[model samples]
Target: MTDAPWSHDLPWPDDLPPFDPFDPAIQADPYRHYAWLRAHAPVVRAGRADARLYLVSRYDDVLAGLKDATAFVSTPPGGAIIPGLLLMLDPPLHGPMRQTISRAFSPRAVNAIEDAVRTLVATHWDRFLASGGGDAAAGFATPLTMGVIATVLGITIDDAARMRDWTNSAVDFIATRIRGVVNPDASVDSYAAMRAFMADAMDRAAADRAAGRGRDTVIDALAALRDEDALTADEADGFACLLFMAGHETTTLLSVNCLDQLARDPAALWWLRAGGSPAAFVDEMLRHRPSVHRVTRYAARATTIAGCAVPAGAPVRFLIASANRDAARFPDPDRFDPDRRGAPHAGFGFGMHICMGSWLARLELRLMLAHIAATTATIAANGRRVPVEGGAFATSGLTRLDLSVTRRSA
Candidate 1:
């Protein structure tokens, strides 16, 4: 990939040293770290307490790296960080697995389920509104997203809460090189619980597929794969795991973030409803308060970024929040101005491997925001909700969202 104009602004450190990821000071306000890294260290060595890795904070470098699959592979071939899961595999092999999953996951297919998703959202909305409202995150977003995932996967709505537990266990934690200096065992237990649950779910689905009792599910379609495009057992499991994780988790976050932003800013909300252009608010929400805050890339080969040469076998962290808020690419990057006349930001991502679900995510957020605005009389900050720690990955968002509302007078 060609180097971008913005790459010129990124400067590498001459005296490189690994910054500690586990530092409480860094965790408290990572933006300070992001500023230091993006301006002075495009590629900086960083220690995550016990874990060692390199941090890549700038937008341009991270974009280049994600596009350069040859130099920054997603996963090794036939790789299963856990057995029977192919979502973790790299390209040549990952291509086929992705194709198989795409049959079910792509925007076209997901679009077909829009009515279902909207209905699910309304079902939760009615209940949440009737309950005099509670934790918006737990009461509404969780069930709404959880039902979408379950329904799409050909599961019963009764399994809504079960799927919620599985999704939370699998994703609601940290994932960066850095973390709080707390229980080593808790992390292990959380991961173990998630994997075990998913494994059981996969096993049950697999058996149902063989017995011809799986009903018509994406899992059944995947299980019944024939010709040259079929997945191995582990690949199926891995794909299922990744699908559930991605489908519900990020969708939930983006919806909450969009609604929260709209409630706080009436002009932005008005912009969304007028001219049939909620996409602007959606773009701003993604740029301003992107759900997935950080992502990782391991070096596939030696490469130079922003004039710094990196050896093969190094890991790089991409601070996405910083990238969206980058002044080089976005004017007044920090301010939440949806009407700012500029190019759409890389809130979803740029280059190859860009989020396939970007459109759907935008649609979901728009609909949910529209629903909340139309249904609720008023939305304001009352109490507060803590953000979940992103664990080893700094993408965790909104463990709680305290929202107060009154019915919109019809």
Candidate 2:
């Protein structure tokens, strides 16, 4: 494999395989390389010469690193590209930021949106069926996820689409820089646009609440926190951007991944149709074909992971994808068996930084899958499979998946 553009900045060990997840070939199928890493070097340093990126592959090691936030920090070496992003902050600081928006995701709030999510799924599925077949990623999955997130954040669907575009641009910008390439202007512009958009959204949400015509929304929650001095305006905007980036995008990927995996396994689909638990199906899918592949942390002090010594302030990467597929953790790890049961997977991450949106995502996937089983007799790939272009190390998902759908006989 070709070296990343930033290799000269911080040379990697020659022994390590030329493994760059963003490389299209590796992105297509990374399991072989992951197997190699797990077997040979569970912990190894890789990335730009200037940036110390240590990758942990084994399941238990990754889980340990994720849970040990004190040693393996969320803040990274320099700081978050976007300040006040909750997922990037370590504890003490992390708790307050998380609590600021936690209420919006409470059990009651999420349950209240169940009908809205189902209606969104059904509406999109109807449109897909009308066309006989369509790209499930864009035509169905993304819209459904974006709609749900938009509803929760009290933003228009159009606004959510715009915010999503900005989020993608910003994420791409940061990913490139992390790889040692420098394309700063566009990504900076994207973050600025998102901040401006979210600020205005908060204003509107606050006005609505004042007028006594308010609905439950993340924006209003953050606005309230800002009023209480629990969060600053910039922090609130950053969190709003996070909601768009993490909340909506990951769920969209999860939906696409579920469709892709189930389409490839007829027996699994049959199980789901024959009264298998949708929750279990989603859990297994998270392990077998997770949307997120890795999460980053910085060594707060000198520490060792998987037996390798890491210096203080070094950047570390936990390979959640590889961890989930670890043979020691899951028997016949590669097999996709919804009926399989045990400990939860690292797909949503581990410990404090574990995805708070996971419950909301699980609810969406469960409902979406159940609805598919009830309405469609079979779904098969009819065209191309376009993997998302970048964020290879971070998320694995499709940008387009054309599928043919057969509706259940009336």
For lDDT, the strongest prediction is 2
- Cα lDDT tens digits, model 2, 247-314, are 88788888988888767876767888899999999999899888888888878998887667888888
| Candidate 1: residue 8 lDDT (0-100) | 22
The stretch of ten residues in a row with the least summed lDDT in candidate 1 is 172-181
Global lDDT of each model?
0.62, 0.80
Error of 1 at 305 (Å): 2.3
Candidate 1 lDDT over 1-410, as tens digits, reads 23222222344344432345555344434555566666765665555434446667777777777667778765532222553344234567656655666665545456656777777767888787777667788888877877777766666666545655555544433221122234443344544554455456556766876777765455555555522336665556556666666777787877777657756766665555465356676777787878776666666777777776655655666677777767778777778887776755566765555675675677666667667656766666557866656455555457688877667677
Q: Candidate 2 overall Cα lDDT vs. reference?
A: 0.80
Once fitted onto the true fold, the runs of candidate 1 whose alpha carbons sit more than 4 angstroms away are 1-20, 23-29, 48-51, 76-87, 105-112, 158-160, 163-216, 226-229, 340-344
Cα error, candidate 1, residue 283 (Å)? 2.7
For model 2, the superposed segments whose C-alpha errors exceed 4 Å read: 1-17, 80-83, 106-108, 172-183
After the best TM-score superposition of candidate 2, give how far the Cα of residue 195 lies from its true spot, in angstroms: 1.5
